[model samples]
Every structure is written in structure tokens, then in C-alpha cells.
Target: MPKKERKRLQVVISDEQDALLTRTAYELSSPERLISKSEVVRLAIEKIARELGEGEHLEEYRAILETEEVGEEEA
Candidate 1:
């Protein structure tokens, strides 16, 4: 399989958010006692995406996605 390029997302967070993620990851680390910080971020992103996908904005969001694709192609 060809390796896919991953886009990097840079976010500025407050100490509270940082602390929550660190604590959450520590508790959720399964099988392996060690936890990847990225896993905490992914869990949050997945939850948000799932909720938004089922919201009234879902159709509107689809329209935005289509427009974004055209914009990307033009870029």
C-alpha cells in the first residue's frame, strides 16, 4: 500500500486543556500502560465529528465540503 501524507494540525491550547488531555490519556491507556498523546486528540476529534455528523448542520456541512474540495483543486 502507498503511504499517505498526513496533514499536520497545529493548535494553541491552554494549560487546563493540556492537563485534561494528559490525565484522560493516562486513565484510558489500555493493554499497554503507555499512552500516545495523539490518541487523546483523536478520541476528541472522533467524538466531535460523530456528533456534528448527526446534527442539523450535516447537510450544510456537506455543501461546505463540496465547496472546500473545489477550492483545494483550484489551489
Candidate 2:
């Protein structure tokens, strides 16, 4: 089997976002298996895409986009 090639992405988040990511990964981890922050991010990206494709959470997604725009303007 051939190795998979993956592109890298750089994301900048606030302290609160970092804490939330760390906490979520910790909560999802267990003695048998540990969840990494990278896994959490990939899962979140897949979930968001699935939900958007299904026409679900549009309002919440819009709100997030608006908030992100404001945050970027502030930065």
C-alpha cells in the first residue's frame, strides 16, 4: 500500500478555543484509547461538513461565521 499524502493547515485560535479543544480531547479519551487534539479537529471538520451538507445547523453556522468575521476584524 502506498502512503497517503496530506496537506497541512495552520489555524490560529484564542485561549478559550485552545482550552475547549484540550478539554474535549481529554473528555473523549479513555484508558483504552487516547484522543489527540488533531483528531478532535479533524472530527469537528468532518462533522461540520456533514451537517452543512444535510442542511442542518445553518443558523448556528451562520452565527459562527458572523462571530468569526467580527473576531478577525478585531484582530
Candidate 3:
């Protein structure tokens, strides 16, 4: 027989959040899987970081265009 995996730490959630999680899990057909609110929050942070990085690149491009326009006016 295969050995069972050891359990890790436990986390508590509010009743409302627990109900939402259960509904989401069932709707997604992942009822047996364990999902963490922390994991969801972490993923949201990562997505926001990626969007901010893209926005920074756009700002850099805008700065370059403004500098080019200033140089053209001086010529």
C-alpha cells in the first residue's frame, strides 16, 4: 500500500468566504481539491504586478516621444 501524505498547517476562513469557495469549487468540478484564499490573493498580486510593469514600459515610451518632440522643436 502507498503511504499517505502528511498534512501541513491548517487555515481558518469566514463562513461567507467558505461558502463562496465551496460554490466555486463545485462549479469548477474541483470539489475534492483544496484551494487557498492566500493563493488566490497571491495570484491577483502577480497579475497586478505584470500590468504595472506593462504600464511602466508605456510611460518610458511616452517619455522618449516627448524628448524627441522637444529635440525636433529646437532644430
How does model 3 score by TM-score?
0.34
Best by lDDT: 2
lDDT of 1 by residue, 15-40 (tens): 77789989999888877576877888
Ten consecutive residues with minimal summed lDDT in candidate 1?
53-62
Candidate 2: pairs in clash: none
Candidate 1 positional error at 4, Å? 3.5
TM-score of each: 0.61, 0.89, 0.34
lDDT tens digits, residue span 1-75, model 2: 999998899988889999999999999999999999999999999999999999999999899999999988998
Off by over 4 Å in 3: 1-29, 56-75
- What TM-score quantifies how close candidate 2 is to the native fold? 0.89
Q: Candidate 1: global Cα-lDDT?
A: 0.80
Q: What's the lDDT for residue 27 in model 2? A: 99
Residue 44 in model 2: lDDT:
97
